[model samples]
Target: MSSTRVSGVVVTPVAFADPPLLNVVGVHQPYALRAIVQVQTDSGSVGLGETYADDAHLARLAAVADVLPGLDVYDLNGLRQRVSDVLRLDGSAQVGGMLAIQNPADVVLSPFEVALLDIQGRELGRPVADLLGGAVRTEVPFSAYLFYKWAAHPDREPDAWGAALDPDAIVTQARRMVEEYGFTAIKLKGGVFAPDEEIEAVKALAAAFPGHKLRIDPNGAWTPATSVRVAKELAGVIEYLEDPTPGIEGMAQVAGETDIPLATNMCVIAFDHLKPAVLADAVQVVLSDHHYWGGLQRSRLLAGICETFGLGLSMHSNSHLGISLAAMTHLAAATPNLTYACDTHYPWKTEDLIKPGALDFFDGSIRLPTNPGLGVELDEDALGRLHEQYLACGIRSRDDTSYMQTVQPDFTRNTSRW
Candidate 1:
């Protein structure tokens, strides 16, 4: 192992423009928050990480950064303990709604873990995937993430994506995404409209792209009965039904009744969540997110557990830029059991902090970077500009339900609304 010590860590909170994509929670705000982490090593290498930049998360990250200097890059467990000891819970712990599986400490530790791994890779002169037991596959596949959206926010002008509220509009949107990015699979974000309307949209997607894999995630907006009904209706067409209902119990109920395999990034979110979910046979597939699962190494562990449990494995995504994408690509390339194409929100965002030619996709797959570390450099100017935007933009937290209130005055969050 290379004995590289971290010299310093810089945490920059940034905000970037986001499209008005609608989901079960609410519309995507004009600006989304993220923290860019840079870990400088004694060996003269800098490793990078990116994650949520909400006020609460940023506070934990800041605390961790304060103590990161002189820490060994290879001592991940020590890093975790250091972060756990430093973290003090505040209201920021409740960002993505109150899921029982959510852990604030994990949120703070994940990005730093990634940053350290990046440094380790650079010090050893190998790719991150090589450190994770080498690449099982050179190309990582990603699905086109489709959302039901308005032309724009209530008062703002429509962005280039336009409105995709109806079946025809959604079909058009998918066509554009596949044509531009060469995505072979599609995942539609549901739970915004009634189940029947969303079902029709999935049917339209199936008809438009015959033989292509398709999925619908409602973020658990339906009851078990409603979830089962939708699953049966689109039984043969969809590859898997994702988060049709909420929680392990609800998912298990729906799974018991439907042949369409159930998948989730919601119910089985953490490592401890695995046993109960597996025992109940609640989820047939687990959508792994490195940000929430701790980091790429932990994600590999999650994949191994899924394989041992006879469950399908795929990656999850939130709104993010190229750094996270590069980390995801390296992790996916190294994971042998990741059978399905991963989900990504990269196509939706118009702006990014990485250099212009950093990442690309062809035929739905990202060719793994051969260079040392993550193989993507941060664009200092873009980073500075986005940081300025974060300073000016006043979105301190992401409350999708509250944001939706502006568009639909009577909007209330009900998981079983349908």
Candidate 2:
């Protein structure tokens, strides 16, 4: 066996403070859930990966961790096979429904694949970007991802950002994000309000912050007709309109009617979705989330496919901490076609599980961390603290629709409500 042979794996579930960020699904939970994966190798290297901490996902992760020992770090294909074997026996069941993905193997395999990539980079004394390919850009730009949120969760004191229920509040949130993070591109999370209301919010953002690239994702809340109307109105104002409607056929309908490029994280997820999406000319941009796309190298393969089909590539995010951020920055740096500023929810959080000073943000982008193996040191104390919070938080899985229903009993998720 190689020195990079796996020794053990530790999967720790953690919870961190999350504001009530509203979206198509529902409001963000009181604390965002994530599983921190540490893959320890025989050579004394530990690589970190972050992923959704839904109870089912955590169970799958634990199962894989049990079988990871003795597998070589560089044997990514073998790793996938092992993950596939374990998951097949467990029976394929989706962890959650916030996003649609055809392959559960991709979901279960992602974090372990990322951890192995980290181990490989550490062993070779190179950045993950170098391993992907040499860095195409030293720093990666990220968009200010604005959400329509409440002042606070029910029965809780107002958090810092306050309530953003209207156009003015959205613009105010944009101002804060751009001012503090220096983000040049801005995106709004739509599908929570009426189409016209969301359109007005985008208009207000355009007036408030001229020259900033803007886009809105409605998460398939509107029908094709409504999506077309909104897209036409915001044609010149938005850089692109994301997931305005659902399904490849639905997106194709919207695409046929508008000049504005359509993008999606919903309909066009997974490798198998690529051919059908391209054939329909349904979307122009595909947002890559490594957590769902099977980690860094496989995500690179996705980039190549997007390039071949002449599609714009952008990265997607969840409520993540620094380890995921570091991995994202490195991947984006190496990806040539990922020219669009990627989306991030980083500025919304006040706490992190990584040690300070591993990454920096000043001008709408993050400079790559130069240290080996993802370049961010895990904070053991912080991990323990967050793990404690997770146990006390009592949220085993995310149920945003139910969470939103608690706040507004009448609330329900609608794919084409408008």
Candidate 3:
């Protein structure tokens, strides 16, 4: 193992323009926040990482930086303990809320872990995938992530992606994406409307693109009974029903009654969640995300546990840019049990911090980077501009429900509304 020690670490919070996409939670804000982490080694090599950029997360990352210097990049467990110590000292250990299920320390450790791996890969002259047990495939497939949205935010100028609320409008949105990205699978963000209306949307998609793998995730907004009803309605047409209801018991109840495979990013969110989820048979498939699952290595561990239990494995995503996409592609390419196409929000993003022409999709798949340490370079100019936006943008945290209430005064969160 290479023995290069980390010399310094820099974390920058940035904001990028996001389309007003709608999901079970609510509409996405105009701009989304993400923090870019750069870990510098004594050899003058810098490894990059990306994660959520809210105020709390940013504070946790700063604490991670304080404990990184003089640490060996190969000692990941030591890094984890240091991060935990910092969070405990700062009284930020209990940063869990409705949005994320893991403790704040675990969540914050993900980006630093990725960065350390990047540094190790660079020193050893290997690709990130090679560091993660080598590549099992050259290209990783991705699904078209469909969402409900207005032409624009309440009073803002319209985005390039026009309004897509009803069945016809959603079909048009899928066609546009398919024409450009060649995605063979589709995953719609559901629970925006009633279950019946959302069922029509899925039926319309099936008719529009026959034999395509289709999915709908309502983010656990439905009751078990309603979830079962929707699953029965779409039976053979839908590949899987994602997070239709909340909690492990609720998901298991729906899974018991339906033939459709139940997948979740909501219920089985962390490592501790695996035992109960597997024991209860709550989910057939677990959608893995490196940002929240500790990091790429831990995500690989997640794949192993799922495989041992005879469960399916897929990937999850958030509103992000090329760096995160590059990391996801590397990790996905290295994992053997990831049978389903991963989810990505790349199409909806118009701006990127990475150098132009470095990352692109072909046939709905991103090719694994062969260059050392992720093989993607950041655009300093773009990063600076986005950082400026982050400073000027008043929004520090993501609250889709609050943003939605600006248009609908009677909006309230009802997990079993359907």
Candidate 4:
């Protein structure tokens, strides 16, 4: 058994300098990615995890620190239960507590979860997936995200980014993902680029790879009206429209108006988030990101709701490396109702991941872990190198990244981190 008592947590930030370039929501900015939360314990055994997007994740981490000084490392269930009870007692909301530890909204949670699970696996001498519920399929299919733009007005910034992306770049990237890396499905960025131009691009790419499945995610950049119009235009060409509307109500309206399947990348948060939409039969597909929900369990909860509502399940891929992608692949493999292709785009991050046997993207599908507890060991050397790179870059801002050092959440003011 390991001898570490959890002491401190560290946040590492990474850059998406080589992000998939495309117009999104009218703006163009390199998609920024934050790394995992490194949990340092007394025994010198470090446990890594990801935090949720808000102060809640920080707060949750801080809360964990409060309880970590003496908590036994091997008792993960006890540790989780303690943290959960504290969250419930504090009335900080169910989503943020566990989710905070696993899916920090700002960073993809899979890396952090993998880190923790890796530590656990090492401690128990097993693979991460074994900790959850033995693996079902060691391989899972992936849909690479062709383009990304994350800004208030994302669709308007392609020219500002300077170099115009050649249409051939899309073909080459798609070809590499398929021919070189073996991806079966590809998701191109849409909704933010000029409507006509975007439609043309989708058409060209769809025709380019007739055998591969094609999907488009606007990232909630289009209005319901535009979504319906675009869906009609892309009908018989595109597979589904993701987050075509900014809101669930809009989705319902679009669902009523169109025959094409309306999927969602956003707007599906938790079980509660799915209720009204599911009841309305607005969503045909559900794309739940662990980064948004926090961990697999919460993601499972969201999936449970999707299954109950008879909605399709697919996960969103943040700009993550191998460790997180492998964890996500396992979750996808385990899920029963995951029919539509999943957005697991870690292959775009790089060829070599920081973990071993975490994922093997072969012929358009990634193999899930047959080992126990998230099933990938972190390459400490690689992690350290990446961490140092982040420190050298200014993007590692933990304090000044937000408008407020500590924004007062409008709800009941908890004296915690957020």
Identify the candidate with maximal lDDT.
2
Q: Give me candidate 1's TM-score against the actual structure.
A: 0.97
lDDT of 2 by residue, 2-97 (tens): 467999999999999999988887788899888999999888999999988988788889998999999989899999999888887534445444
The order by descending TM-score is 2, 1, 3, 4
* Candidate lDDT values, in order: 0.89, 0.90, 0.88, 0.59
TM-score per model over all chains: 0.97, 0.98, 0.97, 0.76
Error of 3 at 306 (Å): 0.5
- Segments in model 4 whose C-alpha atoms lie over 4 Å from true places: 1-16, 23-31, 39-47, 51-63, 72-116, 148-168, 350-358, 396-418
Q: Give the Å shift of residue 356 in candidate 4.
A: 5.5
lDDT of 1 by residue, 1-418 (tens): 5578889989998999888888887778888888999999888889999988878678788888999888999999989889878975544365344343346787778888988888888877898899899999999999999999988877888999999999999999999999999999999999989999999999999999998899999999999999999998998999999999989999999999999989999889888899999999999999998887888878889988999999999988888989999999999999999989999999988889988665799898999988888888899999999999999989987777788898788988767788
* Candidate 3, 260-347: lDDT as tens digits: 9999988888888989988888999999999888888889999999999999999998999888998999999999999899999999
- Order the candidates by lDDT, highest first: 2, 1, 3, 4
Clashes of each: 0, 0, 0, 41
The segments of candidate 3 whose C-alpha lies over 4 angstroms from its true place after superposition are 89-98
True-structure Cα RMSD, model 3: 1.8
The candidate scoring highest on TM-score is 2
